[model samples]
Target: MTKANLLYPRKERVRKKQASPNFKAAGKSIEQRPESINKRDNSGDFEIDTVIQTRAKNECLLTLTDRKSRYQIIRLIPDKSADSVNQALRTILQEYQINSITADNGTEFSRLSDVFDPEHIYYAHPYSS
Candidate 1:
């Protein structure tokens, strides 16, 4: 063994700790969401997220997925602001029968409950899926 290995005595490998959430979730937290949503047996429970293709790209994708059926819906938007996302969601709700939604607590979704009823929407806590 090298001098450094001898000095360290080849200790056991250290386990990496899971990263904690950096951002705070506002409005209803994942904990407050109904247990039934976690079951993922019934339809109408959905999760939504925004995807930016690249930093230079001005447009973003609004993604919605049904937790039960795994049905995905994607919409392209010129911007990822709260107003744009809220309008996209409004259009989607007109087409989909979404009973409840789980969304990340991002700035784009800050006013989601204003667009949709707070009772029908749940924001996923930070560091969560």
Candidate 2:
């Protein structure tokens, strides 16, 4: 017998199937995003992500990107608490009159409605990946 079979002669490996279908395909496609996002001075739209320190459990950096001008802002914070995130967002929004933001599904952003008007802020669907 080959060495591969000798190691586990009676065992069989089964491929695992996904528990659910890819959900991102069900949402509004990126092609559907406004063409204005590519033009200069499109100030209201942004993409945001959080950068966490590998060595520090509580340290994080919030990164925001302006879709049009490709402008970026980063905020370092002691922790990922909602209060901290809200404060950081408020500071960024104050600097620029942000109209909308897109972010991945993260618990840190769950309190967005408390910080901004729901009508003004839009969230990408959680399952969209």
Candidate 3:
């Protein structure tokens, strides 16, 4: 095998640790949503989700879309921390009136009820979406 004096590459393969999803929902369950919201009979009801930047792990986009109107609001957040998400939601609340919000079971949304009414924040089932 060494007849041609070929150099053997000595390199170690490092595996990155995968982060587990925080599947705990922060607020009320989606099943608790009122008929007005469930049927999309109102304009103030909205759905919230976060889009993480692929290249910048620390940066994310918070999106809110009105269920009835399909209008959307997108904001750039510095991180996925609950505090950052609350801050972004607070700012949005000042400009818009959101009657209710539906979010996934992400840890970053654990504090959503602090910014909005606890009774109005609904969470989807874990791992369903």
- TM-score (all chains, Cα) for each model: 0.77, 0.65, 0.79
- Candidate 2 least-lDDT 10 residues: 22-31
The per-model lDDT (C-alpha) reads 0.84, 0.69, 0.88
Runs in model 2 lying further than 4 Å from the true structure: 1-41, 127-129
Candidate 1 segments exceeding 4 Å error: 1-24
lDDT for each residue of candidate 3 in 38-128, tens digit (9 for 90 to 100): 9999899999999999999699999999999999999999998999999999999999989999998788888888888898999988766
Candidate 1 per-residue lDDT, tens place, 1-129, comes to 675758557667888554366655657778888888999878999998999978756899999999998999999988989999999999998988998888887889889987788887788756456
Q: What is the TM-score of candidate 2?
A: 0.65
Off by over 4 Å in 3: 1-24
Query: Judged by TM-score relative to the true structure, which candidate is superior, 1 or 2?
Result: 1
lDDT of 3 at 46: 92
Candidate 1: deviation at residue 29, Å?
0.9
In the range 1-129, model 2's lDDT, one tens digit per residue, is: 775768667666886544245544222334455556535356868777788999987899988888877789899977987788889988877877776666665677667767766544445655555
RMSD (CA, Å), candidate 2 to true, equals: 5.4
From the highest TM-score down, the ranking of the candidates is 3, 1, 2
CA shift at 81, candidate 2, in angstroms?
A: 2.1
